[model samples]
Target: MIPQTDPKAGYLAQRAEIDAAIQRVLDGGRYILGEEVAAFEREFAAFADARHGIAVASGTDALILALRALDIGPGDCVITVSHTAVATVAAIELTGAQALLLDVDASYGLDPAQLEATLNAWPATAARPKAIIPVHLYGQAADMPAIAAIAEKHGLAILEDGSQAHGARLNGIGIGHWGKLSAYSLYPTKNLGAIGDGGIITTDDAALDARLRELREYGWRERYVSAISGMNSRLDPLQAAILRVKLTRLQVDTDRRRAIAARYDAGLADVKAISLPRTRPGAMPVYHQYVIETENREALRTKLSERGVSTLVHYPVPVHLQPAYLGRVPLGVGGLKRTEAAALRVISLPMFPQLSDAQVDQVIAAVRASV
Candidate 1:
């Protein structure tokens, strides 16, 4: 069956380069945060058009560190959407801050209008709203211009969660440009993925850059000296080496993903049963997962599987509705109506750079027949 996403395919596509990177790391005695990790950090930072990059162990750590760097914890509230990877909310909570969940727009991003309304009606007794983590979900940018304007008015910091949006842009600028700092997950399935679990944070602020480096390694400005309270979250050298090789090809890969998305758009436009993914005006999404919404998601998923095509739900349940956070996590002013709707309907079709034109046609055909 065609897979929803193929990380292994990514490896196979560049096997020789990846193997050489691994060999290079093995040859170098230092296995931890060595030259490989340092080089990847620099390369990725340049790619993101940021002043600095701090490599971390996981995407969750990237968020946590970004929050900590900003001193957002306990008695602090961070606004983000409910329709996202659990890691987004989990990272905020891990940082000891309260997560105020919000709704998404039609493009499956944070609603700027809701953000304005929520701040206007925010209870005085509630945790002080300190930051907004606008997740660039599905590699599509949130309405940063509107969000940034609202943020500026309210004195809230913007921390972009660009986990899925490696090469995405809005109004001629990168997704992370509007925020003070941005966090990205380099998971095996992400656009600029590492071979294993990895993450990175980028920022234009030199002070934040230095603080993030210290925070990642037990507050180590000088070795073995605990300068401040921090945790251990360093990117592995082996993964970093592999990512360096992958980084060189990200733009080409992103172009291929866009091509596939265009094909899906043409092929599935007439399927009345499904709503195709939408791109915002002046935005260029990298198509991490070409998701479509259909009320009969489970039925359609089953049908596609039966027809030898695989699909997966971007998120089967909204974070607030999940058992771990139910009845506890706060919601925005109007509640997560759009987020809840998306959870029940959205399903991600097969999406990856390696998918050939013929395979894309197969997926489109299967989707047409199934829907």
Candidate 2:
């Protein structure tokens, strides 16, 4: 069966280059935070148009460190949407801050209007709102211009969760550049994935960059000194070396993903039973998942599976509705109406850079016939 995402295919596409990079790292003998990691950090920071990059052990660690670097912890409240990978909210709570969930617009991003309303009606006794994390879900950028304006007015810091949005842009500015600092997951299935678990944070502020470096490695101003409390979240040298090779072809891979998304868009446009993903004007999404919505999501998914085409739900349940968060997480005014509906209906079709044209056609036909 065709897989929903194929990281193995991505590696095989550049096996020789990736294997050589890995061998170089193995031969160096300096594994943790070594030359390979530093070089990969520099190259990734340059690609994101940022002043610095801090490589971390995983995407969740990236978010946790970014929050700590910003001085957001106990008694702080961070606003974000529940319709995202649990890592986003989990990271906030990990930093000892309360996560205030919000809703998303038709583009499946943080709803700016709800943000304003939520802030306006925030209870006087609640924790002071300190930051807003607008996740660039599914590689589509949230309304940054509007979100930024709101954050500025309310004195809240902006931390973009760009886990799925490597190379995505809005109004000519990269997604990670809009906020004070952004975090990206280099998990195997991500757009610019590494061979193993990895993550990176990017920022333009030099002082903040310095703090992040310390925070990720035992708060070390000097090795083993422990200037402040921190954790061990350094990116592995092996994954870093492999990512360096992958970074070389990120643009080409992103182009292929967009091409496949375009085919899906055109092929499925006429299927009245399903709704295609929407791209905001002036935004270029990398199409990490190419999600489609249908009220009869289960039946459609089963049909695709029976036909030998595999699909997966981007998220089967919104975080707030899950057992862990139910009746506890704070929601904005009017509740998460859009987020709740989207969770049940959204299904991600096969999406990856290595999908052949023939396979793309097969997926298109399968989806069309199923719908």
Candidate 3:
């Protein structure tokens, strides 16, 4: 059976191309924010359909730096999903802003209805929320159209967490271009991942773009006189080079993911006791993780494991309950009821572009038997 995921298969497939990229970076001594990083930023910006792409140290820093660029700080609250990676919430806290935890819907993204309800029910006098950070959880784009409308109505900014979605799209717009700003993770596991930590922030706003360029660096456009207390987060040239190579193959890799997902859908749609993840019409998902929902999640996982099929939980705990965000105020509706329920019941199956059809069927058979 195909393991839950394998990052190396695809990397190994293009070992020679990847090696060349690495060697090129190594030979080029300018390591930080050098030509590779600058070129990648330009290419990534074009790919995302945004005016700018600011490279950074990691996805977490991308968010933190974005917040700092927007001047969101102490006493400011950021509305966001509590069912996301702890990084989403942690980044807000790092910027000294309060994280208002929101719930996710059955689609494994932000719940539009819940988001509206929470905004309506917010206790007045709470720190006037300056922004909303909706996570594109597990590679699915959050309901950006709805969220965008809500943010506009409430004057809240949008910062998308697009860590898992490199090629994911909604209504013809890529995930990174969906919100005012999107934070992308090139962590080794992401769809268009780098060999190591890397991140980019995409935005159409020129002013914000300029600010972030300064914000991600030493805040000095000119040779480090320090314009702000910006941290030392910069994308290394090697990661940028590698990611550029990876970026070129993203569409092809995403197509393979679609093929594998379709295989799973074909095999398991009628299977009892499990509900496959759904992709809404007008959206194209990259299938970063083919997660399934079922009440008997643990049992199914155990059975799959025993059968040599690897599985993973996208997230086992809702961000609100995490110690770091404990007692945080709720941002969107009832503080993650659906998220909590989904967390307990969901399990991600084997997924990768290079997975063979035989391997797909093996995983399907194992899952069916295990379930």
Per-candidate TM vs. native?
0.99, 0.99, 0.96
Estimate every model's Cα lDDT from 0 to 1: 0.94, 0.94, 0.84
- The list of candidate 3 runs beyond 4 A from truth reads 329-331
Residue 10 of model 1 has an lDDT of 89
- Candidate 1 residue 20 C-alpha distance from true site, Å: 0.8
Residue 152 in model 1: lDDT: 96
lDDT of 3 by residue, 75-177 (tens): 8988888777788888998998888877777778878898788778777976567998888877788888988998899999888888888768899988866
Better of 1 and 3 by TM-score: 1
Question: Which pairs of residues collide in model 1?
Answer: none
Weakest lDDT window of 10 consecutive positions for candidate 3:
326-335
lDDT of 2 at 115: 98
lDDT of 3: 0.84
RMSD of each: 0.9, 0.8, 1.4
Error of 2 at 302 (Å): 0.8
